[model samples]
Target: MKKIILSLIVFGATISLASAQILPAFQIGLKAGTNLSSLNSTASETFSGSNRAGYLVGVWTRFGAVGFNFQPEMYLTSKNVDVTSSSGGVTRAKFTSIDVPLLFGGKFGALGLGGRFYTGPVVSFAIDKNQSFDSAAGKVFSLNYQDQNFAWQFGTGLDIKRISVDLRYEAGITKQTYDGRQTRISLFNLSLAYSLVKL
Candidate 1:
């Protein structure tokens, strides 16, 4: 019993020391953004759709010191898209999902202001029972059920003191179309984040 307790205590101390050496600072922040999204068709078919606007609100946490950082964020995002069929009918779809992103970044510059570039993978899970098809016209449409999606995002930002502004682009890797057709989500995001707590 004594040997086991000593080993556990030593292991915990080693882990704490390693963390203190590698990551000296931590921050928690709030972020809000606008999403300009479109439903894009695969090469085999043609899709007629217009870009739709949506909003995102989230909480994010960052760890590490000056040059390198790792961030994880959770967001409530509105994913809206417009689609038009060959029969001249339009259907608007609205999907609400929870998004989690793990980002690795590099920060540079001096003084109280700096610049950062980041890239990450995002996983999104749908919260609704079915993919809601709102307001449709022309022909009857069958909506695809996409409960989860995977995407990648890359962006650059300006970080000033406790706040940051970012411009990012995201591309969906998983196709979310029914009827043997391929479709994906693509979007541009502009966001502002404020650090609420620093440790």
Candidate 2:
């Protein structure tokens, strides 16, 4: 038991030492990922909502010390959701928007690896100039897309050299309207990013 404990301590010390050796002051990267989204609502008038897959592509920049940093990201997001009304009517919404998230987080590392936990507000702007949905004409509720929306995100990330991965959960701070019925969007987003510039 003593030998095992000593070995573990030695390994941890080595990792911590390596981590302190390589702390970058700044970095920039590009990322792409997929998301699963569901509609959340407490309104009695609403029916059911199911999850749907979506896509996100974007770029990110990070700055500060090794233990604490400020990260900002901009991405183009495509979201899809399927909602069923009480009257058995269904609507499929596929919307595209531009998202900007300003994140503040702390990071820790071992050896050549690191982890980060972050929280931030994400502001989304609608870019559905062509139309938010392909068809909502037949649904029981008429769909109307919002021009802008706000949400909060909490997530963790991993960093290995120049590569990083992030998993985040987002919940709406305000309700969005579709057919005049208000609902919140809740989603899980997973992304892979590569740093192009690290200083």
Taking all chains together, each candidate's TM-score versus the true structure is 0.81, 0.82
- On TM-score, the candidate that comes out on top is 2
TM-score of model 1 (CA atoms): 0.81
lDDT by residue (1-199, candidate 1, tens digit) is 9999999999998776554334477889999999998877764244466788988999999887746889899999887776766655556777788989899997776555878889999999988633334435456355473789899999999989899998999998878764456788878989999999977
Candidate 2 C-alpha lDDT tens digits along 1-199: 9999999999998777556533557899999999998888776466667799999999999986647889999999988887777666777777789999999998887554989999999999989733332234344554455779899999999999899999999997767765567888878999999999988
The C-alpha local distance difference test score for the whole of candidate 1 amounts to 0.79
Worst 10 residues of 1 by lDDT: 129-138
Measured with C-alpha atoms, the lDDT of residue 31 in candidate 1 is 100
